[model samples]
Target: MATICISTVLNFRLRKPRGFCCSLSSHDKMKNNNKRETPELLKIAVSGITELLRIFSSSKDQRLDTVTYTQKDQPLVSGIEDIVDILQSDYENAYFLTGNFTSSIYAEDCSFEDPTIKFRGKDLYARNLKLLVPFFDCPSLSLQQIQKVVSSDKSCVLATWKLRTYLKLPWRPLISIEGNTVYDLDDDFKIARHAESWNVSALEAVGQIFTPGT
Candidate 1:
């Protein structure tokens, strides 16, 4: 698991510059946001492992994208260390390519469609995890949920740490070594953070977002 995870993360950099842009947008939101003179409904990118595995295999071992946390900047968060323990212990799952289900990973010309997965060992739930990532300019965002959020909204982007509130979201952390330390928040007034983010960039490099596109 450790070798696989490391190889996977390092492979996100092998893409040609054009590879980073999503098929849905003309360019990354930073560059293309200006060309469109009118407001458009945002088509958000949700994380999925299938694509990350592909991307990592193709990306020649470069460090995967870094996401600055909102909690690193906030002084109010307390008792957060236990958050890591909860995640590492309670969450456990594995990612595998869905045979030939790769064509539908990204939606067709106009929709934000995501793939479908079958997990029955535990109940699954969905929610929106609002993140203050440096790479993004949007105020709110979403992550495809793999757990039940009986107490949270679909609007909140997830963070490893808690902000004003957190839904006790479930996380299936990757197995790893060398560093199990959770990232500390940056100095940028970090408010909230995701308790878990499955690293899936490697899967994307090879166009394995989701073959079936369900």
Candidate 2:
């Protein structure tokens, strides 16, 4: 007499409670979905950046590509074109986080709590953060590479910005190209006065924040 195990039969359903089918492997899933690679704009950008930032050591006369901002003695992303794009581009429903805000800004070191970061800002706060990214721009040795200030790190300024409109008359808003909230480019000054909450304490904490436009 052959007996089928009831537990085994029931467990099959448990494996896929959603019934969405998990049998397909990650690679297989992409393949089945007909995933194809888009033109790698990053590589092209890297090459052009490398050309722009051929020299390093940080000097007023030095031909640098990237620039940095030091408001309270902290290293901020400031403005690396590619990096800006990186921060602006939308991710696959992701999260961008770091253990220490100090380290994240200064060291370029980050520990993304979420596997991916959808830079697209669905919230006002997120939009403001995107504007802040440019404030960190510094002269790069090569494209995204950081260029030390000839001697001391005092080449850029650290300022604050706002995501929404606040001007009494009219506020020129930046529209994200990809329809993502993160990539907004304003023709007029992007900084919103009241919306900005920058303070000496915040600047001091960040250390070496910059206010270039200031």
Candidate 3:
């Protein structure tokens, strides 16, 4: 298990940005308020990886009850080209930041792994993304390259991306990470595994959380 030092960081809170517009209607404002209850939510958000690891282990059997879609609504693709298109579109729209990617493209038990943690089940993966949404301020993911590759009998979709996000810590640390993800497809073309390789070490990535923003 990887350990991160965050004892001093958890007391942080998120404040609305200066000159940020809030023009939501009454109903919309109520809904947004219901979605996030502050202070408590802030506590959960800033604990960061420790909280994520706990949730990853504890949520193994939980289903993604947040999403509902019938067969007609599923973005089921028959080939790598279609898969690539959907993925690119999702990244373009920053769906990954919002935890609303097209889940139909991934296997029900698809495995997800990065330098910090690893887990099985796409439902769990989605839940993890949803958990991190509270701390992702002005997040951006730039897709540099995406292509299909085959090596002997195995094939996968590899995508390189640059990610920059201002974590809602007290000092507002800016995390900039460049990484590539390998999506291994199953027989039916659904993603069986999603593995990420970062340009920095696990320690370095964690250290970014403590570095104060400029």
Candidate 4:
């Protein structure tokens, strides 16, 4: 992100009557005033703006990059190997997640629900992920189990996983949560609905926060 600086200065001097102004000094004062004020005003305005922008830009960058987590080197689970691979690769990369997986793996009218929120449609899901980007850094999801069940015309996958993350908060830097997702797949194997269940509740998550690596 870049910050734009705009500095403007306007100086106006009202003309005085010749009788009120000193005759000997009036001409010299006028000449010197124009020469001095213009450059000084510009310099003052420009420097002030530059310094303010420098401070603002640095602060903004720090806030955006504050949250940092470690990626766990865990192997994928067995059953849904292909989806697990995609999760490890594309979904893990925060930058690529919204663009790649949301459109391909999920149906447009997909319903998603977790402990915190429930929403329908891929656009809302993408928006929720975008909101998380600033607060999530280097987050990793490890797959523990994957089971596939097929009925007459429909199929579903149950995936159990653990998410380990470092939340860049002064009070709680480390957070670990275990959860499972059940995916209802359409005839083409695209995800029609996704739901999640976590071992911890929202208040429990707040209580479980600890220091990183502890």
Candidate 5:
């Protein structure tokens, strides 16, 4: 449960109506009228503040029974559990490498970028993953950390991960890369953009030519 406290200050100014026979110029009278309107301005300000307090109070009541994640709950994101499940099954699921992600978790116009490629549209993204699947054996993606950010119109998930696999060369060296990925979700909560950063360069990855145990 969350609590909100609102403090309001009220300012009052009392003014008596001026006589029409006053000798002051029109400009002077206008200034006096403006001074008299301070109470009205304060009324508007108080109304706005009251409405804001009401809104906050209502929101707190509605969320009282719900569990909210604070900064202490690191690596938290809405719908992240499902996304993790999908990623964990990706190595064994041909559909994940093919087009399943397109209709399931990704927006049709999603964009994806990594060290080697940058592209938009779910179809092309799925195609790229399919093409890369054949060059690796026993690939695994493990999530090391996750963080969620909510904004006015969209939400994002940042994940630190490690990808482990053996390149299908004659030596079949075991290669492991630590990387981070940012996934942006659209209004419907489908992945709209995905970008990855790797700790090692592509050339460095290619240099791992010998099997680890050999």
Candidate 6:
């Protein structure tokens, strides 16, 4: 949840200039250009190292502190059928990406978790979603499938989705994640836990932030 602002390292495949090393003046010009870029490249490298250090030094619980949670009016979900309908409608519009989710269907202390972080409190989750708003460029969440699963002992809603977004970085890195969420309903039929599983490993997902656009 740290708002990372590190620039991705660029790999340039420079083609050899025609008649390279034909003149001493040309070689000197190239050296000057390299010198001019060295500082900028160093800055980028430093920023990237700092960001990673911050991520690793902080505990998962500490990361939640970075998000700002604002209290909002809480409402109740009528029933299981109603919750399903609301979710279907909200997901179609990518409510999560826009921070426009209906907070009523979730308990005040509903737990949320994806590959990166886990925490309790619906307000915190909502605020965290809002944090991504500034950095998101053409974000999309496609709901592949959704269903209510009921069993003798457990009942929940399982929804599969694909999320794609371009982070507003200089490199225009793309974050593409295919995942599913399990919304566990409490006895009162309110969502108590929203757990997600991604197709890629956690490290791979993190790596996506540093990769150039595909």
State each candidate's clash count.
Answer: 45, 33, 0, 0, 1, 0
Error at 70, model 2, angstroms: 2.6
Residue-level lDDT tens digits of model 5 in 1-214: 0101111111100112222112223224333333322234444554455345545544656542232322221223357555555544442343322323324566778876443333477655443343344455676666666666666655666555666666565655666666555667776667777765555534344345343424
lDDT of all the models against the reference? Answer: 0.21, 0.20, 0.59, 0.45, 0.45, 0.58
- lDDT digits (tens) for residues 84-179 of candidate 2: 333322121111111012212222211111011111212322222222222222211111111111113212111112111111112222111100
Best by lDDT: 3
lDDT of 1 by residue, 24-137 (tens): 221233233223221121111113442444355336433233311222222232333433333222222111110111111111221111112211111011101111111111
TM-score order of candidates, best first?
3, 6, 4, 5, 1, 2
What's the residue-level lDDT of 127 in candidate 1? 7
Candidate 1 vs candidate 4: the TM-score winner is: 4
After superposing candidate 6, which stretches have Cα over 4 Å from the reference?
1-77
Report the C-alpha lDDT of model 3 over 145-205, residue by residue, as the tens digit. Answer: 8877655555677667777887776777877876566678877988888865555543455
Query: Native-vs-model 5 lDDT?
Result: 0.45
Each prediction's TM-score against the native? 0.20, 0.19, 0.69, 0.52, 0.51, 0.65
Q: Which stretches of candidate 1 lie over 4 Å from their true place?
A: 1-78, 93-191, 195-206, 210-214
lDDT value for model 6: 0.58
Q: Which ten residues in a row have the lowest lDDT in candidate 2?
A: 8-17
lDDT of 4 by residue, 43-123 (tens): 355445544544564465654223222344443333344554544454355322123343566677987643333347776
Candidate 5 regions exceeding 4 Å error are: 1-102, 209-213
> What's the lDDT for residue 37 in model 3?
28
Question: By summed lDDT, which 10 consecutive residues of candidate 5 come out lowest?
Answer: 6-15
Superior candidate under lDDT, 2 versus 4: 4
- After superposing candidate 2 on the true structure, give the runs of residues whose Cα lies further than 4 Å from its correct spot: 1-36, 40-50, 53-60, 63-68, 73-176, 179-214
As for TM-score, the candidate ahead, 4 or 5, is 4
* Candidate 1 global CA lDDT score: 0.21
